[model samples]
Target: MSIWWSLHLRREAASVPLARRLLLGTMESAGVDPDISYDLSVALSEACANAVEHGGDGALDGAAEAYRVTAYLDGETCRIEVADSGPGFGAAGGDAGRLSAEAENGRGLYLIQELADHVHFGTEPGLGGAVVSFDKILKWRKGASPLLAV
Candidate 1:
């Protein structure tokens, strides 16, 4: 079975946990394993935090204060994408894998890469924003089939 959802949220710190909770609820209800669910929730938080912090035009007003998040669950795999209207990673030119440990910031992408089974960066659909997408292969806790919930 396949399930998906998308959320267009304000670029606020509070919105981060809202997205995480929703993802956790969805996965738990579908019988996803606890460990996989925890990892994905943490990874999703990092991705959402990145979008909230960097995905907007440097302006503090208007439409620049929003980001989009999408998630898909298909059988044993779950994919997630977070996109923002700010300048993309390409413009910043920092490698996600090479961040310094002592830096006060810049670890979101690295965390996502570490948690997700696959990761990709690109432009948001039709918005020219930075998009960080990742996916993980899920393991059911007791041979449960998520398709049944579909």
Candidate 2:
């Protein structure tokens, strides 16, 4: 079985923290622990920030076109989808490598890849938008992949 929650908000700096908090709350309610909760929060925040940054100009005209987030929970697997009403970008593959020690930026996808068990993009052609999704496995039981055997 799966459960989902969604919300849309202005694509602004202030909305980033709000999005993080709301996602954290939902995950916590689903029994995600504190440490894991922090990971989820950070990953979700970075994804949303990326969306807004690349979410194209005039995407948020005083809360007009907004960014949407959808989270789906199924047992130990929780998938978070952050969608933006703007043009999409090409995949970086799982090649979301970490930034160099001296680099000041470019670690968003890298962090998300490290924290989430799976990360993928859902691009809707013609519609001209995309959904960035990452999945986490909480309290994994036997037979689960060791990478997500938290």
Candidate 3:
């Protein structure tokens, strides 16, 4: 069950579902349990949504025009990352501000923290942007792929 893919997509709201759909398709084909797949997909969407919102709005024609997403599934675990081209953490809507306002509204970052088993919130090295990464131990359906059974 070694599978991985990456995408460079424009910083747009629609890119969120496009990325999620791809992940879902991959998981479905791999015979992953639907519940687990849904959890990961939700986390992935939050990460991407954050990127689109805080990944900077300038430079539409330049390298900053898009964000990056990468997912890797190996053995019994799956890891995913979403990186933006804007300012990194602490500056993303201000960490303190977001935390304080958490009770009043839904924060994508917070939702991601709740969904994924292992999560990392950090800056993209040298790129000067936020990178949200997470991993979860995978479970398979009753008749999962032979590769995953081992």
Candidate 4:
């Protein structure tokens, strides 16, 4: 069974938990293992927080200001993508894993990389925004089929 969902949310701090809760609920409903679900939820929170903080301009000047979060589950693997309309990280994003421990910021991408099985940084599909995408190999609870037959 394969499932996918997407959210377009305002670039506000409150929107971060909303995305996380939705992801958590979806994973739970699909019978994903508790550990895997927790890890993915935390990783999703970091990704969403990044999008909220740096994804786009928060001005209310009639511009379509928002960020996007997308998740896909197929069999034993799940992939997630978070995107924003800001100027993007440019060259800095390439060094995401090299942040120092004492740094007050710049740890979001590193956390995502640590939690997800695979991570990618790029532009949003069709929207030309900064995108951080990752995937994990899921382990479902007992009695859960790897693929849900639609």
Candidate 5:
């Protein structure tokens, strides 16, 4: 069974926890291993926080007021994508360099990279925004597989 959901949320602080909670609840109800769920939730939170803080590129057209979060559970993997209407990663969009320990920002992307099995950071194609997408091989609680008949 493949389960997927998408949310378009305002670029506000409260939206961060709201997205995290929905993902957590969905995973828990689906019987995903708690550890895996927790990891994904944390990564999701970081991604959402990044969007809330920087998703808007400071345009007067009001185009960057919201962001999107999409999650997909298929077979043995869970994939999540967070997209925002902003200036995007620009030239520093990849793992081109390491951040200093004293740096105040830009840690969320690193955290997401470390927590996810595979991560992809890029712009939203020609849409001119940042898109953070990652995937994790899911572990199901014994008798509670994501593939189980619902």
Candidate 6:
């Protein structure tokens, strides 16, 4: 089948719920299983929240920076992309996967990588801004099985 679904909106934490609903609903309507749906929602929420909190002003104003979220589903594989119109981080260092039990933050990248089958962070096309994408592998079932699965 095809593999593309997208939604773009201005940066605001309040809009995160909207993005989550849209992304999760798209996967559900595309026939993704329930378990995959839950994972998608959780991962997307984290990505969108990071974008709103770090990329934009987290305001309701229309002039605020923009956040674009795109989701692609093909067979049992789902890919999600979250991009923002803001400056890119120079160098992503530090232990993203710290074992500390008292850390307040710095786990966004770690969680994304841990949960997703595949995760990537980079500058958007044409260097527009930052783009974070992750891929989810759904459980195979019935007639949805492909010749060779992931």
Best by TM-score: 5
Query: How far is 41's C-alpha from truth in model 4 (Å)?
Result: 0.6
Candidate 4 deviant stretches above 4 angstroms: 58-64, 91-97, 100-102, 125-127, 143-150
**What are the per-model C-alpha RMSD values against the true structure?**
2.5, 5.7, 2.7, 2.6, 2.3, 4.1
Residue-level lDDT of model 6, residues 78-114, one tens digit each, is 8899887655443462344252335687477667776
Superposition error at 63 for model 4 (Å): 5.2
Tens digit per residue, CA lDDT, model 2, 33-118: 66777887899998889777766546335432577888777767888888776666544422234443344664786677778888
lDDT of each: 0.84, 0.70, 0.83, 0.81, 0.86, 0.70
Quote the lDDT for 65 in model 4: 71
lDDT of candidate 5 over 1-150, digit per residue (tens): 778999999999999999999999888887899999999999999999988988997777877999999999887889999999988877677441464434566787778878899988888987888899999998888777565234
lDDT of prediction 5:
0.86
lDDT of 1 by residue, 27-140 (tens): 988889989999999999998998888878877566679998999998779999998888776644546546554556767777788789998877765667788889999887
**How many residue pairs clash in model 4?**
2
Question: Number of backbone collisions per candidate, in order?
Answer: 1, 0, 0, 2, 0, 0
Give the residue spans of candidate 5 off by over 4 A: 92-103, 145-150
lDDT-based ranking: 5, 1, 3, 4, 6, 2
All candidates' TM-scores?
A: 0.86, 0.74, 0.87, 0.85, 0.89, 0.76
Clashing pairs in 6: none
Give the winner by TM-score: 1 or 4.
Answer: 1
User: What is model 3's C-alpha RMSD?
Assistant: 2.7
Give the runs in model 1 whose Cα sits over 4 Å from its true position. 59-61, 91-93, 97-104, 143-145, 148-150
- Decreasing TM-score order of the candidates: 5, 3, 1, 4, 6, 2
Please give the distance, in angstroms, between residue 28's alpha carbon in candidate 1 and its true position after superposition: 0.6
**Candidate 2 Cα misplacement greater than 4 A, ranges:** 57-64, 91-105, 140-150
lDDT of 3 by residue, 1-150 (tens): 488999999888999999999999988888888999999999999889888887984765665768999999888998999988787775443462354234654377778878889888888777788888999998988866634545
